[model samples]
Target chain A: MAEKLLEIKGLKTWFKTDDGVVRAVDGVDLHIDRGETLGVVGESGCGKTVTARSVLKLIDMPPGRFEAGEILWKGRDLIPVPAQEMDKIRAREIAIIFQEPMTSLNPVYTVGDQIAEVLRQHDKLSRKQAIAGAVEMLRLVNIPNPGKRVHDYPHQFSGGMRQRVMIAMAMSCKPQLLIADEPTTALDVTIQAQILELMQEMKDKLGMSIMLITHAMGVVAETCQRVVVMYAGKVVEEAPVEALFGNPRHPYTQGLIRSIPRVDRAAAQKERLEAIPGSVPSLLNPPVGCRFAARCKFAMDVCVKAMPPLKEVGPGHRVACVL
Target chain B: MSEPLLSVRNLKKHFAVSGGVFAREVDRVHAVDGVSFDIGKGETLGLVGESGCGKSTTGRCILRLIEPSSGEVWFQGADVTRLGPDAMRALRRDMQIIFQDPYASLNPRLTVGAIVGEALQIHGLAKSRKALEERVLELLETVGLQADHMGRFPHEFSGGQRQRIGIARALAVDPKLVICDEPVSALDVSIQAQVINLLEDLQEKFGLTYLFIAHDLSVVEHISTRIAVMYLGRVVEIAGSRDLYDTPLHPYSEALLSAVPIPDPTVKRKRIMLQGDVPNPIRPPSGCHFHTRCPIAKPDCSQRSPELVEKRPGHWVACHYRG
Candidate 1:
């Protein structure tokens, strides 16, 4: 078995919202082996982003609180680490790529300069060497005419190019783990493919583990080796990509798999998709027992009475359901 | 086909790009350049493209939300482009629009009932206050929302519920046509399916025609009777949904379809990934709009633009190389 690069155990991240405490990450246990790609799939407010943020201690304090969890990075607990130490680990050991590159990238600064700044701050490289390294990073990500485009402002670059620049910057420090939260959601399909391809290439070239956070199951099936299905801030299912798609154990996962409109010739005749009936439960005062019980078709009395713990159903396949 | 419900001819929307201190018009961004299509009565026409590809612009042009630069918008039997404000107001009764972001599209201060009833009141469809309330409640139920939800604000509802409210508002006027601009893109995977299914159910029940504009090919394939692929302000491919996805003729359409990551992990596709970014529409490539990124480009591709020509029965393609 491959060595584990990151292991999250019983993680619980909560936020103090106006209504009450929102259990954004109720209890998520996930692990990523070295050089592996793990996809965390969930809808908006499912707490996938919150879980990713907790890995780096990026969540804002006061409102955001780590209730009970162990974010183990290379066997070291990150939850209790000092802010200064956590800052060092961020971007050096682990880096994140956001959904929107326009807001993420500095509008005033040139893409090259911004990338170089990361290298300079982390590696303590000279200005000239850092700029050279930045250009090289851009080249690595397949940006054309990196030398000239390096001087161009963010506005000059298109959405896809800006995303590429973001990838270059994130990959500049050569982190052991890359956390991409909806990285290609903002880009067009063609550009999204290019970015996904670039990320795949970067992962292979650098031998880094990627925790892909996206709502799109297609993206997960295409990029991820293992898949983690999250709902209402909890891990409902985890399995290898093939197993998850082939035979989804959890009701929520099953609903998601069935809901996506397939482009395959077989699905050409499908008139109506199997859309899940209800919306995701609010984190604030979430329903008792199974978080998905209200919307789940297979909900039993036990499911509504108490939450099911994540239990292995098959080899490397876990599901959180009484059934 | 009984003169098709909506016919757009040479539709173009160009925004002037001004530079220098003088703010003079240096060029124009050809958002929707000479794109033409027809939507038969009670048929769903899916407009798909990457961001900045003018899919949304084309939809907006039909409703005169963003006035087209030059085009003939033939709705029913009248040229909507020439309609005065008062006449256009009357036309709105027969046509409505559903926006992508349900949160932003709705008025935060207004109750759900008011939001849905506003359209009916504006169109003079409701006879009395009680009648308006009853109609609003009926619309709410039609969209899978409860009567209690009518009293709630937008913030009280989830993203999916907000989308339902948007749908209810669109259906309030009993419009013949609804321009749904990326309606489900803003929704989650599970919620997206719900909205898509609701749209389909509503379409069948009311015999409502839809110009569904979205970027996701798979989602577009599910609801659309016909699909139109746009690239940089031009319609590259337009065909029946099944035919277009199964056997895409245009290089752009083929590449775009190939890029859609299928949820099934077992399916491995040979993706014809295009090169580089979508060229700036302000200074678009001289010939074909997609020639800069066309994977199967020839010498002539950069010299002359291709007109949309019917390649097969009910299938139109704009490509020099494609038969």
Candidate 2:
């Protein structure tokens, strides 16, 4: 078996609001092998982002707390590590590219300066060397005229270019894993494809693993080797990409795949999209048993009474639902 | 054939930008220039483009939410472009809009019942309080929301549910033409499909026409009978959905189509990365606005703008090199 670059076991993150505790990520388990791309998919507020943030300890801790979890990076448990140690792990072993580049980047600094800050802090490079590295990173992401664009502020660049700059900055340290949270959500479809292609190239060249969080199954089908389906802060299904798309086991996964509009199929012949009825359950009072039971068409009595443990149904395929 | 529901001809909205306090009117953002399209009765026409391409402005101009600098807007055979505020207010019953951001578009202070029934009250659709409550419940049910939830505030609902409420509000006035301005862009993928399906069902039941403006190609292809590709506030290509996707004649359209990722992993798509960022809207490129980034730009592209011409049956493309 390939060595696991990142292993997440029984990860549970919660937000303590005045009203109640919101279990954002409850007993989620996933693993990304070295040099592999894992796609994490779910509807909005499904805890896909919370899972990603937990890997980096990026969640704000005032109201948010990491209740219980073990994120193992290269055999090191990131969850129990001290803050000082976790900082080194964050800068060297794992990096993240956020969804909105306009907000992720600082407005006060030039694009180059922002990127250089990352390199200088992590790699301990001189200011001059860091600037050169920033330009080099920009070129790697295929930003043309990087020499001039380096001095431009974030607002000066278009959405696509800003995304490229974000990617450049994230990859500046050549981390072992890159967690991209809906990196293409804010971009046009054309620009989205370009960014995805660029990420694929970077992965191939750098041999870095990726945890891609997106709501678009089309993106997962295209880019991911492995897929995890989350529903209301829990993983309902996990499988290889082909298996998930070809024979989705969980009802939520099946409904999600059936909902996407495809161009290849005849429009009139296509069935009315089968949406998973009802919205994602509230995390503050998430349902017992399967979180998806409320919306699952095939719900049984067992589904509502007790939480289902993720069971291995086939080789590398796991599902957490009482069928 | 019945008269078209909405006809927009030579619609233009340009914004003058001054360089400084003393600077002359140095540039104009040709946000929407000479864009023309018609929405047939009970048909959905999808207007698609990248950000800053003026798809939203076109929708706004037709609704007169933002007055166009110049154009002809003919609704039900009447010239609505020249209408004053009072006339426009009277005409508002025939046209309504559903904005993209559900949370931002909705007034948070109001309850769901008030938000949905506000239009009915303003238009005097219901006289008694009891009559308004009944109508509001009917509207909520039409969009798949429960009547019991009417007393709840906007923040109480999820993004998907909030959008449904927005849709219900738009339908409250019994409008013949609904301008959906990227209504599903802010939604999760599964929720987007649900909303699109709901929109389609509502149109069929109400015999309504929709001018759907979005940046997503696949979603547009699935929902629209006809699709128009816009570039720099100009319509670059327009055709029936199948023809446009199968054999896009315009260079920009071809590039745009090629960028959409096929959900199937076996199908490898050749991605055409357009060079340079979208030019500043304040000083859009002269002549053919897309020439600067267009893959196949002839010398004539710089000298004169191309007019939309029929290359195939029911397919129009604006390109100097459309052979």
What is every candidate's C-alpha DockQ against the true complex, given to 2 decimals? 0.80, 0.61
Given candidate 2, what's the lDDT at residue B231? 94
Tell me how far the alpha carbon of residue B195 in candidate 1 is from the true structure, in angstroms, after superposition: 0.9
Q: Which regions of candidate 1 are displaced past 4 Å?
A: B1-3, B20-22
lDDT of 1 at B28: 93
* Model 1 per-residue lDDT tens digits across residues A148-174: 999999989888888899999999989
Q: Local error of candidate 2 at B131, Å?
A: 3.1
Screening candidate 1 with a backbone cut-off below 3 angstroms (N, C-alpha, C), the clashing residue pairs are none
TM-score of each: 0.97, 0.96
Residue-level error in angstroms, candidate 1, position A168 = 1.5
Global lDDT scores for all candidate models = 0.91, 0.88
Docking class of 2: medium
Listed per candidate, the RMSD to the true structure in angstroms reads: 1.6, 1.8
Considering the true interface contacts (CA pairs under 8 Å between chains A and B), give the fraction that model 2 also has. 0.56
What is the docking quality class of candidate 1? Answer: high
